[model samples]
Target: MFELLKQPWHWAVSGTLIGLIVPLLLILGNKKFGISSSFRHICASCFPGNVKFFKYEWKKEIWNLFFVGGIIIGAFIATVFLTDPANSIRIAPDTAGILNSYGITDFSSLMPVQLFNWSNLFSIKGLVFFVIGGFLVGFGTRYAGGCTSGHSIMGLANLQKASLIATLFFMAGGFFSTNILIPLIFKYLQ
Candidate 1:
């Protein structure tokens, strides 16, 4: 069982599990599912008197906070205990070659140390990528009414048209960032 837990499961396994979540949540009378809403719940619980947005009965969604907490704890356990260093960050040769062209040589960790390390956080590239990018993501998620997981998974499962539009834009934005923005950043900034 321990060895099985340590091994990587097939993509289908995760897909099936995620597929089941929609129906399970529906049966349980829960309409929403995502990490973003947990932030709202936390704010509502902590700052009930501060903002009109945070005046709701956050206790109703307390389970979502626990769910997000579990995700963080699980990630820590996976990275620190379960991960085999040799198999940490596997990339295809072509993908590695492409990244190498962008001055991203290190692939020893989940993300490129050249990009994600603490030292890079103080640099101009990191300021744009992390600080500004993070704000945009937060603003986008709020403006869109939900995050990618909420829209792509739960909202689409409920046949919401807005989710479909949001998902399409999300894909397009990802493509633009990967193909256009990232190369520009690497070429000019690095």
Candidate 2:
């Protein structure tokens, strides 16, 4: 059982489980499955500000907070207990080549130390990758009404047209970032 847990699960297995979540959430209490709204719930609960946006009854959505907490806890458990020290992350040869060109040869961990270390955090590349990228993601999430998981999974399952459009844009943006923006950032910033 332990050995089976250590090995990577096929996408079909994971996909099936994720697919079940929508129906489960609906049947359980008609709760919408989304992650991005949890941040707003947290802010509303903690700050209790006069902002019109945060003035709603966030308590009704308390389950979303628990869902996010479960995700964090599950991540911690997976990282600490399920990780196999001997198994290093494998990068595709094409991806390894592109990273090599950017002087990122280290693939020992999930994130290469070259890009993720403290020193780089203050550098141009790090500023673009972390600060600018984070801000854009936050803005995009709000503008899109929800995150990728929410739109691509729950929204699509519910046959929402807006979710379909948002998911299409998400895929396009990801493609553009990988093929164009990343190279430009690496070329200019690094």
Candidate 3:
């Protein structure tokens, strides 16, 4: 069982599990599913009197907080225990060549240490990637009324029109950022 946990599962297995979550949540009278809404729930529960946005009955969504907590704990456990140092990240030679062209040679870790290291955090490139990019993600999530998981999974499962539009834009933004913005940033900033 432990060895099985360490190995990568098939995509269909993961996809089926994720797909089951939608109907399960719906049957349980909870339509929403995503990490972003937990922030709103936290704000509503903690600072109800401070903002109108935080004045809702957040207790109804308390399960989401636990779900987020589980995700964090699971990630920590996987990183610390399940990970194999020898087989950490395996990028294809073609993909590695493309990444190398963008000044990212380190494929030893899940993320490029050259880009995500503590020393880089204080650099201009790091500020743009971490700080500015983080701010944009936060703003975009709020603007879109949810994150990719929420819009793409739950909303689409419920057949909501707004979710379809949001998912389309999300795909477009992802494509543009990956193809154009990230390359430009790597070319000039790094």
Candidate 4:
């Protein structure tokens, strides 16, 4: 079971499952689905501020909050408790060699790698990066008015041109970050 979960096929299956979600949401009376919106809905409920931008009747019971929470909890369980291969795609030996040159010798060691190292979750540098990354992600989700899943799936499902553009930009950013930025930073780390 663990080995089965590690295959790229598992990721493909997961992606297919996610691809179904947007259609399901649309069929269910067009729920305004998106992770970014869910975050806003939560903030508005908590703060209940009077600012023009932050104005919303956030007093309603946010079912989406529960849904988002479920997704998060499910992810943790899948990674930690579930026996699986963890969807790790190995780098080529040459690529890994270059990475080692830049200071990331056991690169995969930085992450769960095997999904059992709960201690790595609290390492000093790991904690710093996690907190900062969480903050940036939160801020970006709010600023973008939706997260990747929301925009790419629900928004695009509804034929939103804006969502299409945002998703394209998102892919471009990811490509640049992984191909260009990751190598440059790894160089400095060494």
Prediction 4 TM-score vs. true? 0.69
lDDT of 2 by residue, 24-77 (tens): 888999998898888778778999678887889999999998988999999889
Q: Write the per-residue lDDT of candidate 1 for residues 12-105, one digit (tens) a residue.
A: 9978888787777667875467768876787788766668888887888888888789899989998788877766656899989989998889
Residue 2 lDDT (model 4) = 65
Off by over 4 Å in 2: none
TM-score of each: 0.86, 0.91, 0.86, 0.69
Higher-TM-score candidate of 3 and 4: 3
How well does candidate 2 match the true structure in TM-score terms? 0.91
Tens digits of per-residue lDDT, candidate 4, 88-178, equal: 5566799778756654555453253432345646664344346655677788767776778778887787788988988898788779866
Q: What C-alpha lDDT, on a 0 to 100 scale, does residue 1 get in candidate 3?
A: 86
Backbone clash pairs for candidate 1 read none
| Best candidate, TM-score | 2
Q: What lDDT does the true structure give each of the candidates?
A: 0.83, 0.87, 0.84, 0.67
Clash count for each candidate, listed in order shown: 0, 0, 0, 1
- Ten contiguous residues minimizing lDDT sum, candidate 3: 25-34
Q: For candidate 4, give the lDDT of residue 181.
A: 74
